[model samples]
Target: MIPTLILLGLVFGRWWRSSLMAAAVGWPVVLVATDVMSIEVGLLGASALATMNAAVGVVVHQMILRMTRQLRPAGSSRSGA
Candidate 1:
């Protein structure tokens, strides 16, 4: 789940989209897994957890991107100029 969220964050490159996708993907599994809670409760809980995890993933992805950008050589250029 963690890896999936991180991958989504990196792939999507947007926090909101990654969070929404995480919630959508997690909600069904959570709804089915916890018999102790009502559907509504499960949904809320799952959505919250998914959103938080995705946010963290997005932060991690952004940090990695920043670090990589900083590490690149100043002379490197994508353009032929």
Candidate 2:
């Protein structure tokens, strides 16, 4: 799901927006799941996980995008070579 969300971000050329969207969607789901399942969870722990998830998704997506750009043919439109 993280990868998919990142890909969606790439497709839309707005990785930051997608990263924030994932966090927005994920935090609430985690909160609800924890509550409905009667699981003992701490706010700090859940928040940490959500933050890590968002950071990883954005970082990885950017890295992949960078690699793709570097690997493209130099004469490609974006490369302007």
Instruction: Please tell me which predicted candidate would have the highest lDDT against the true structure.
Output: 1
Model 1 TM-score, all chains together:
0.58
Among all windows of 10 consecutive residues in model 1, the one with the lowest summed lDDT is 9-18
- Candidate 2, poorest ten consecutive residues by summed lDDT: 5-14
Candidate 2 segments whose C-alpha is farther than 4 A from its true place: 1-13, 21-26, 37-41, 78-81
Backbone-clash count (model 1): 0
What are the runs in model 1 whose C-alpha is more than 4 Å off? 14-38, 79-81
lDDT of each: 0.66, 0.60
For TM-score, the strongest prediction is: 1
Candidate 1 C-alpha lDDT tens digits along 1-81: 557655666665556574667566665566568664456656666667766666776777778888988998878897858
- Tell me the number of clashing residue pairs for each predicted model: 0, 0
Residue 5 in model 1: lDDT: 59
